[model samples]
Target: MQLPLPPSPMALPLSGRFPAPFLPPSMRKAGLLHPIASASLSPTIKDETIDWVEATSNFFEKDTRPIMLFDGVCNLCNGGVRFVRANDRNRRIRLEALQSDAGKKLLRRSGRAPDDISSVVLVEKDRSYIKSEAVLRIMEYLELPFPQLALFLQFVPLFVRNIVYDNIADNRYTLFGRSESCEI
Candidate 1:
């Protein structure tokens, strides 16, 4: 039996596949051509701000660069970390397994559940981004196509982006398999 598909940004043309800004104004306004919401027409960085006040108040005790805190035991999370490590030539993207002391501190500071392996966290001095926003923002550290792709995905709303992230996260262990530790 064919299972019903989940409602996704893919349903909104010029969104899931190609970058929306690439579409001509004529195509975008056509509505028939681009099924995206009008609000998405304008640039909006839909990053969720996590409160790190309590966590970083004194424990961290210093201005830290952007840190990518991930599920140390999740294979999928490890693979992503490796990919970023390789592509992030400058090493601007720092990684910390949520299973680590530093990672736990950052998560608690950001008011995130340390056990929530389903969501990845990107912590910066000013703010933190979780879930899909973390993934896309991390892409900016890479050269070429990755940042470009992130630019396109940024236009899509967080709710729309989360659908895909949540689906994969829900079945990550089953699909990519899991390990006891994703430490690098």
Candidate 2:
């Protein structure tokens, strides 16, 4: 008589491969094993801690600019920066690549992770905004018809607006193409 075959390897010790209930609490809390956590934990910068004096000093010393932070490697982003500069006419807006050291510092000081910032960032003395909010805030600072666009914020829901913004951002390279170099 043939003996019964043992259970397949896949059927044995399922918990060994996939410990649904035995995973460490820290791993579960982090959602994933992030490199930042592995390195060292430090106090995150608070919005109230932004040094306006330092930011303004850097802006003046670097280029006497307003410090617009954008994706340094994105072609569409570079073009958009140029467009904003051209439209400003007054030349009030200054630019910096998010990849730059200064940009990273500012982001950190603002309680944001540089790697996680995918949209344009406009930082002022003590405040910051992201995505569509950043765009609208910039327009408001332009001090003219651009400020009128801020009215759109009232009519559009934040969730709906972010969806459109995120879609464009996700496909910007494919739709608008990319640049070989990061332009200021």
The numbered model that scores best in lDDT is 1
Per-model TM-score versus the true fold: 0.66, 0.63
lDDT of 2: 0.63
Tens digit of per-residue lDDT, candidate 1, span 62-104: 6355789888888888899889988988887778888787887
CA deviation > 4 Å runs, candidate 1: 1-63
Q: Candidate 1, clashing residue pairs?
A: 55-109, 72-182
Q: RMSD per prediction, one decimal?
A: 12.9, 15.1
- How does candidate 2 fare on TM-score? 0.63
